[model samples]
Target: MANTTSAKKATRKIARRTEVNKSRRSRVRGFIRKVEEAIASGDQALAQAALKAAQPELMRAATKGVLHANTASRKVSRLASRVKSLSA
Candidate 1:
């Protein structure tokens, strides 16, 4: 469907970028899941550690445009609160 050579190249680039973004999204989800699992298992220490590890990954995903800034912030906030409650 691309009429120009440049357009074809752009399409290719988009496809590659989509794959990369998909991977990043999946990775972020995996990190979040680990935190959730730890929390559900009632291991406050493991949950806190998982949250610590996931915070930067979530922020990085937002910075890279895989997630919105507010969305990432809200997730981090909620997770942090839950972790705090577990310890307290």
Candidate 2:
């Protein structure tokens, strides 16, 4: 129940921002999933490529406030390690 005009506008803004953030989060997850799938398939080359592509996307999400800096870094590190292990 937004009574004031500003409140109504704010509510709308929040709705729009929520949609954008949701999309960004989903996109980041999709990228991560690609890397994981590649790794699981035991294709080291594909996994490495996917990780290369996902790294920037993950950082972008963090920069846009969709994820925390440390969270994104941790994810990148874990994924990278997994990709590395795939080669061994």
Count of backbone clashes, every candidate in sequence: 0, 0
lDDT string, candidate 2, 1-88, tens digits? 9999999999999999999999999999999999999998999999999999999999999999999999999999999999999867
lDDT for model 2, please: 0.97
lDDT of 1 by residue, 1-88 (tens): 9999999999999999999999999999999999999989989999999999999999999999999999999999999898888877
Question: Which window of 10 residues has the lowest lDDT sum in candidate 1?
Answer: 79-88
lDDT of each: 0.96, 0.97
How much does each candidate deviate from the true structure in C-alpha RMSD?
0.8, 0.5
Candidate that scores best on TM-score:
2
Q: Which numbered prediction scores highest in lDDT against the true structure?
A: 2
Clash pairs, model 1 backbone: none
lDDT of 2 at 49: 97
TM-score of each: 0.96, 0.98
- Look at candidate 2 and give me any clashing residue pairs: none
